[model samples]
Target chain A: MSSLKTPSTFIEGPTRLGKAELAALVAADIPDGAFVNLGIGQPTLVSNYLAPDSGVTLHTENGMLGMGPEAHGDDVDPDLINAGKIPVTELPGASYFHHADSFAMMRGGHLDICVLGAYQVSARGDLANWHTGEPGAIPAVGGAMDLAIGAKDTFVMMTLQTREGQSKLVEACTYPLTGVGCVSRIYTDVAVFLIDRDGDHGGGGDGSVVVRETHGVTFEELEGLVPVPLRRP
Target chain B: MVTITQSALDAVADIPDGATVLIGGFGPAGQPVELIEALVETGTRDLTVVNNNAGNGDVGLAALIGAGRVRKVICSFPRQHDSHQFDAKYRAGEIELELVPQGNLAERIRAAGAGIGAFFTPTGYGTPLAEGKEVREIDGRHYVLELPIRADYALVKAHRADGVGNLTYRKTARNFGPIMAAAATTTIVQVHEVVPTGAMDPEVVVTPGIYVDRVVVVPTAATPRPEEDQ
Candidate 1:
């Protein structure tokens, strides 16, 4: 196991939940018969923690439905890959279709859940994941925009704070937005946040952010760590 | 009658300069590499090529761009780690790029195939991508108008093809091939093998023969041959 680095701030203390633990938390919340699309990078790990009989049908935007877990060794097929280009297995009732059809499912509001990694999620559930708007950034926006707006519920998986000890759950996203007010839940290493359009914190009436769960931190500690005000659920 | 070309070069000979061509693939998967090589060999220039991602490494569409054949590239992910050629060229203003969001790109091509005029999508609304475009509000949600993307020719790759050009793709390699086939005026496919017309199961054919104009069988492990060897 890799060593955990100490966080710079003591407001919320340090999070003991790593990626696998965070993924497990998210995986446990996905209800049965949910059609889920796991985005690239960290969100893909959610598949590993799902129960064998979870009855969740995984979807890949590249043109696959009913996807199974990641493939290993001899089971890896070069042509059978997810949107991230990683080899994955297909479930018993898996089906393949045209690329356009896959996007139609994504943008047509057919997916029950789409879990994505984010750079920042605003207090009003606005998502800023595709670009940081930094100088010389490549700015490759793949399918995040479609999934963010089209999924029935959008969930973000990331650390609550940046490596520089900045809170990602912000009053306003500094980064370029991928979608406006699309995130429903955020699953971070420190806690789970439920964001809604309640207009509590007064950033032009965007929305309010509330803590739903925490690993080892209290609501006051989390609020103190965050740059903006956060309410309790 | 099945129109089977003797070689990739022969199949691509009729593609004129400045033709709008749709090359199917996401990265290198499902890319008609040999057909791209043939296009390079055919010396077609001033091309507008469309695909999902820009070419990877220094081959396929990247090689074509490096060869100074392409005038413009329409794609979503144009700058991967190995896309140095496109990056340098785009930075130097040698080639033009129209970056589309991946889903929007796919939908545009599919719209052309499905004979749709235009559609409103919420993917690019409230962003730079939605700038200077028609925006509408339906049920208090914003959507931007996106038009269909059609091409004069489409180059695609498939796992197998029937003698009459019915094609079936292999796994995830099917990425943009089927949609590109439908969106182009003339679709040319590179396949591993071509069987009798009735050999393939009708249920498994992803692209029916009506959309395919030419079929070229690419030999496994075949490399670009020198002019002298040819």
Candidate 2:
């Protein structure tokens, strides 16, 4: 991420997981029998790592459940496109509905988990992915806000830092927020954060975030880069 | 109560300029391409249109937007990789946009069709999208009041329709078609095929004929059309 900085002499041979490796890690963590919706961008790659026999159902916002992988030459149907407008295939047990029912599946808490790509995620689990709030920028919210607050657990997939080496996991999001305290976990290149929502840190911004795992960087190094404090889960 | 039309031009002929219309599709999936192309041919302008995305590539809704027929677009996501037509017009301030969250867009349309006046949702709560809206705490959670979106006409594409105009869509393409059909004063549809009355099972009809006003059959792929000779 952001031109891997020259590591200090403290940690020897620190290595980071690639996108595929990180997706595989995320896939392995998903429990079977969960109904999931993966946001359009990099989060779509997680389906590749999921086992075919896995009972997880893919829900595309366009209007279908049991969505399969991308379509091939003969299988391509212009009418069978996903939320990203890319042609896709339908798996067994796939069902179609109107946009109202499709969104109801999400906003009604029927979806177990949703993985979304993010620009910034607050330590308190606030999400800011819809609009960047730049001048003259045409903002498009799509289903990001509904998915963030609707799913039982919202998971964010993104690099921990931006291209300028600014930490994306920040004390607060400067951009327009998608939801407040909605994120449950963040899967990144170097670390996985598990937010303790049950902790009695009400309105204190002291979220007691747990560093479940770390890659490439040591715990202390991560803490130094992160704006918020982290403890081992 | 639906009329079976022979052509897209004839199907959408009565839609007046400046009328509010709901065009169904999430990208090109359920888009009424031929009907929109005919509307472009009709030179209808100053229209308010609603859909999911603004447009995709250079056909269907994109063509309508590029032709300057739309005065405004109320949609969820109006920006995409291939949405250059909308992007350019939007940047030039030639078109107006009312961006709604995806769920709100759908539910608002659904509310209109279901005769609901207004409803509250928690989607944009505490966000900038909720600014200046009526907010109330329901069950300790905040919700914003959203009004229904109604239109004068709705154009949709579907897989099949019965002689009486009961409609069924193919796969993911069913999105917004049924609700838009109900939300509009006149709903026109373009389908690949039309079956005889009673041929479609009552249990299988996604949109009943009562919601549909007109049905036109436009075969996809390269079906040669007769020259528009006066």
Candidate 3:
């Protein structure tokens, strides 16, 4: 249980960790041959950190499967890209499919794990990724809904709190819910916490495991990476 | 119509006060900066805006909130960015806000495009979203009623287009532009380049020409940037 107390759970950091540290941390959870969806931003970094020898296969919503991590500078492939339009590398078995079929894979629950970026996440496991309520904003939802529902396990990759000093993990999201009770776990800049699946906030009553701080650092040190000091509800 | 170098007022001259406009983009990406810039200069007020995420501050759709022109906002997540005016107006109840789950909003607009009256989904079952909305159980699972979404004007961005208006979007920035194009009465597109007819591959055309009404070329504009991509 003490080893679980890793300091930062984010993909990027000022800590400038070695690539092996990053890959080892992520690869520990990724089972062999797990089908995973990598979200656009920081979540995408996980692909690069996935251990090379692991059997993890990455699926991109934009229609690539068996994707490998980012290529070294000499090996960058210009034509192959991820949903973020960033040039990436593909594993030997990488396959391309029609966009429709790709979406079907997402909506039909074929994905085993999906790491997402969120604006807010409730303690009840609701996700709010789309829209933030200002005027002249772009009005649309990307493929987030399909992944939230279709993935066998939904994990959120975000700071535990918002830049405005608000906790993303809440009793209930004030914003609209992306998926009701779909979140399985949360990885933040500070620590890793699993949702209390059992209905009890204390971790044992319902089936939900209580999330404890993994790293030995101060909550402020964790918050500094995420840019928000989280207060649990 | 007189052409001025970046004529601010002339751009939005046709958009009347109190008109409901749907702007395209997922987050801050693919927003019609030209139209928004023009809307700001034209001093139009009392507009109902629909979009994904509001622009942060002094950018994107959030700029309208900063200008205090939006009367109402129909969106999903409106509290992500820190906009003083958005927070102030929302707290004071100065603006009417209707929040729909992200998927529901997309499907509603897609339904509008297909001319389907409404489609049922299980997104908001047994929750606040199911409140007030009609619900029906299908095979033991709950479903919620979602109405189609249509806007008076749709503003979009594209990487390339033809004279007749087939569109191609830069990757990532191609979030809501094509969908909003189908859900609006009049669709205006801002493009980086307009190529000769038949230049763009038919297979690559994202939005067909039938949905586009007007084209506004952004001269010397680089590719549209998706805020989340970088």
Candidate 4:
């Protein structure tokens, strides 16, 4: 039993890191030449920091493929936008098509990574991003369910805690579920954690996803790097 | 216990003609009949109704078609009931039909809820669905980004509810209710029954009250005719 106990591993961030640094943490783990989806909110920041030299292709559910990060003011294309209605820049090789095919790719499991914003993430990596019913807010769920289930790997970006001081990471989600057993990892302000499935709770699958604390380094700095001596505790 | 009132009807009482409503259903399977009946009884007209399918001719959402309330329908399939009014209207072009693939319909609704301006996919690529749309390719795969679809009003059904308006559907009926709940500017629910908080099994509750704005409880009549029965 003593041998079974593992020490909790923590990725320490520098005192404080902004959104860009956090996004780079997410972008760093993505491999070269991958098909990716950048969801609304923090997930969108990833494109801005993806290694300009990497051959990664970004797909927007709205219809743009090979989307580049945000463009300079002079480079903005009026017709180029993400799911969030934010204007975006297209890569040199980017192309557009009817929106139907975009979702098909999502549902078809052709994506390598899809980064999304989450309202809560369960320990098992379940995501809930659709509706919190905030006052006067539109009650919409969007493509959260499809993305959560369709994407090959679902990575979530969110704060460790809510404004009211509630932890977004829970043993189980109180919100409506987008996809069952679909979350892969979580990137939060405090730290990054891989949702492990091997705990004694006896769920399905081994916990293979890796989570590390981003103590403040940019994803650019962390990409291609894994902890030298991973502490399983 | 949650109690529904006639006052709930007030919400749809003033809808003007030529309204575009996003109704929930893949036919009688999940359509909200009480609300459709309310719309038909209210005599609202020229409605461009968006749904997964038109309901059986005389039951479910088809009641609106029977009453000549739906001026058009944007959906994937039509209920096969021989008496379906929407089908006749659609065939005569008396009602415009904008057919979307089932998955596409769900995605467009979700896209609107996510606040996405537009997106592309290969589902409708190279087909009529691609006409008049920009085409793009990435990594040798072609795709088309679609604009999100939003509706002025969305009407849905729930099996049970609480005073706070959280909801849960019986089973597979949970289907498009959750999606439609998120894509509308104003969301109203017609519940078969209203229950007290904590009475429903949290595990079974599908739609949370947060997305629901208004709800009305009326005793549900007999089940709508199923497509298989037709």
lDDT tens string, model 3, B55-97?
5556657778778888988876565534455767777777777
Candidate 4, A38-106: lDDT as tens digits: 877668888877887789998876556787665457764434455654556766887654334566678
lDDT of 1 at A215: 72
Clashing pairs in 2: none
TM-score of 1: 0.91
Candidate 1 C-alpha lDDT tens digits along B1-230: 45886599999999999999999877766778899989999999999999877677778888999899999999887867677878878878888888788899999998999999999999978777788999999998899999999999999999889988999998777989988999999999999889888989999888999899999998682322111100
Number of the top lDDT candidate: 2
Q: What are the lDDT scores of the predictions, listed in order?
A: 0.82, 0.85, 0.66, 0.66
In order of DockQ, best first, we have 2, 1, 3, 4
Question: Model 4 off-target regions past 4 Å?
Answer: A1-106, A110-233, B1-8, B79-83, B201-204
Cα RMSD (Å) per model? 6.3, 6.0, 8.9, 21.0
Please tell me which model should have the higher lDDT, number 1 or number 3: 1
| Candidate 3 segments exceeding 4 Å error | A1-26, A31-35, A38-45, A52-110, A116-147, A156-233, B1-11, B82-85, B222-230
Residue by residue across B1-230, what tens digits does model 4's lDDT show?
22345444575776669887888754454567777777877888989888766666586577888777888777755534343586577656677767664556877887886788887765455434456889899886566677777888888876778877788764334556777777887788887788877887777666777778788876653456443221
Q: Residues B1-230, candidate 2, lDDT per residue (tens digit)?
A: 89997799998888898999999988777888889889999999999999998887788888999999999999989887778899999999999999899999999999999999999998999899889999999898788999999999999988999998999998887999999999999999999999999999999999999999999988762211111110
User: Using TM-score as the measure, which candidate wins?
Assistant: 2
Give stretches of model 1 more than 4 Å off.
A1-15, A198-206, B221-230
lDDT score for residue A183 of model 3: 78
The per-residue C-alpha lDDT of model 1 at residue A102 equals 85
In terms of lDDT, the poorest run of 10 residues in model 4 chain A is: A224-233
lDDT of 1 by residue, A8-76 (tens): 232333555899988988898888888999988889889998888888999998889988877788897
Question: Model 2: runs farther than 4 Å from truth?
Answer: A1-14, A200-205, B221-230
